[model samples]
Target: MKENVFYGKGMGPIKRDFPDIYEAIVELNDAVYTGKVIDYKTQKFIALAIAASNSDDRAVKKQIQSAINEFNATKDEIMDVLRIVLLTSGMPPFVKAVKILYEVME
Candidate 1:
């Protein structure tokens, strides 16, 4: 899949380079899947918001695009959550995320 492109390219090396960190990420993914904190779609949105708020462009774009592809989330819905992220996290993060999203779409 398009998302796998990054990992398949060269990111796998970095992931494997840090076994402990990679394991923690794997554990977190498992918890997120198994935990009942929210429904799958909502969880995806929350994760997208957090990534966007952290100004992690690659992560933000990946999660947002994944949600769109997997859950059929509309652009407006994604933007709404992004707006909330901006409110909670601040302008800088929001702006960075928006720029990344725009770049990805283009």
Candidate 2:
């Protein structure tokens, strides 16, 4: 199954709405692919942290589950990422993201 919240459609609206931000993201992707600054596992952890920090429930759940499934990360590892997000980004978003992870994992 192709698990995309946008249902496999491209993020055209986002790109159109936030051209500069979207361009930066695209550039970052290119740099990551070219420079290899971070490994896949570390990138996955960072993604989970960012998603949790932003309180993007869908992204948090999806990335957490994907990391567990793809990288064999344990619940402890997920919690560790959340903990870091909580420290840096505060508690409300972390709480919200953790609730989603709990529901999905349960």
Candidate 3:
């Protein structure tokens, strides 16, 4: 219901211009973030991985910030997740993630 600064630039405008889509997105975020089986911290890592895999820099930074703010995620924890991204998604995404990782983790 409230504006999510976590969603990054342009999202507020999108919410105003396309409320239906935004609502659906919010619902999806709620569903995924509930962490029915995985637990919230683990889900945050997964979300971070997904963001990296997609090469969505905004989402990557958002997830990183959220995980750090909410879970107090450490640099090692973030690197661990990025390692998985590297192994599965290859080098480029992993490198990008590593760059953002340092930007946020410090």
Estimate every model's Cα lDDT from 0 to 1.
0.74, 0.75, 0.84
Alpha carbon RMSD to native, model 1: 4.1
Tens-digit lDDT track of model 1 for 1-106: 1222232244476587976866676666676565366677887788889888888877888887787787877777888888998899999998888787676566
Per-residue lDDT of 23-70 in model 3, one digit per residue for the tens? 888887787678678887898899899999988888999888888888
- After superposing candidate 1 on the true structure, give the runs of residues whose Cα lies further than 4 Å from its correct spot: 1-11, 14-27, 35-37
RMSD of each: 4.1, 5.2, 2.8
lDDT of 1: 0.74
lDDT score for candidate 2 against the true structure: 0.75
Worst 10 residues of 3 by lDDT: 1-10
All candidates' TM-scores? 0.70, 0.68, 0.82
Where model 2 places Cα greater than 4 Å from the true spot, the runs are 1-35
Residue 68's lDDT within candidate 3 is 85
Worst 10 residues of 1 by lDDT: 1-10
TM-score rank order: 3, 1, 2
